[model samples]
Target: MEKEIKKVNDEISVAAFDPEENSFKSFAEKGFKSVINLQTDEEEQNVSPEKEEALAKDNDLEYRHIGVSEDKLSEALVDNFRQELENLPKPIVVHCKSGKRSGALVMMHIGCDKDMSGEEVIKQAEDMGFECDVPELEQFLKKYVNEH
Candidate 1:
């Protein structure tokens, strides 16, 4: 929890740093059961996936890395991410370079899960400190909500 942790709800949080080994233990001590990473291996500032997975195991936290690039976001990807979010044990911590990608996915999941309007979802995310500034992500979310 060295970085700022933005709680989206009681069950979920988003942050920028991939917790280090000690921080993983802190996360478990703080009641986080899972860590979901949205950045790809190639992303700048990302820790190696091997290290992240191992640390989660050492700390008794489930770890999942599902990379989502802005240019490549699709309904199928978001649907898959939503399913994973539903299945993963919580309270969960999701992170990317700056939390934007994680926020986008979480916002989309909330919108789809609660049958909320896209505007409502965006406002909720903004209130939680996750700015949805990526236009591709915004467009995808709007389309996803309309179709689903």
Candidate 2:
């Protein structure tokens, strides 16, 4: 899979494998305050939400589990997730199976919340491999801006 882990930036990072699952124990040790997991347990090979929750709790980080799917990335869920996200502390690690869908959700959140253009959002999402091939996701995003 070419190691689906990278610094999307400095504060926000993405990964298919959790740092708690491997090296980089510093992320956990340094008291990162929150973790928003977009990954569903069944889809990821070795990731367990229970284990993640344990690690986060052990590190005193607040944890939220929002299990989004290719089939159900709807507007309502996005909005609700965004609301919850706004309440979380910084240095939040939002992750999914490959972090691609989480990146897509982040793009959608930016578009829906900050009035970013659909073209701008989709372009960023495409850079992360979160394309419009999925009908549900496309329809939801289209409703966000009335364009494909």
Candidate 3:
């Protein structure tokens, strides 16, 4: 399937596959400075992290692999993801197998950083063409808001 890039906001976008060479060039030309991959290396049909990273670097885009698996999703991971999102240069592209994890992580970052409610975050994600409905992820987000 051809990967689609859905812009989440002015500074961030989400997609599935790692951009190929031409795609990377287009992103660079369009001013995207970095990419964050949320899929684990072992995921079926995933692009090799090493190859994708090399291509991104060759095209002058900073590449970060965060590798979040379904079973390992947690508040700490969300925190680190947010830190990376804040630390990385924008505009950034975050991607997973189907953009689900990427979108969820972005939602968590927005919920925590902007103090948005879970419903608000879900609505925002849906508006961006990403459905955020992972129960574990949602629970973690709720607990995080309650704690902090």
lDDT (0-100) at residue 113 of candidate 3?
A: 72
Global CA lDDT of candidate 2, please? Answer: 0.65
Better of 2 and 3 by lDDT: 3
Give the per-residue lDDT digits (tens) of candidate 1, residues 1-148.
1577788888888875655556677778889999988888777654577788898899899999888888778888888888888999999998887888888788888887789888888788788778888887877777787667
Q: Name the lDDT of candidate 1.
A: 0.81
Clashes of 3: 0
lDDT of 3 by residue, 56-132 (tens): 88889998988898798777887888888999999998988778888888877777678887777777777877766
- Best candidate according to TM-score: 1
Ranking by TM-score: 1, 3, 2
For each candidate, what TM-score against the reference? 0.91, 0.75, 0.86
Model 3 residue 20 lDDT? Answer: 56
User: Which pairs of residues have clashing backbones in candidate 3?
Assistant: none
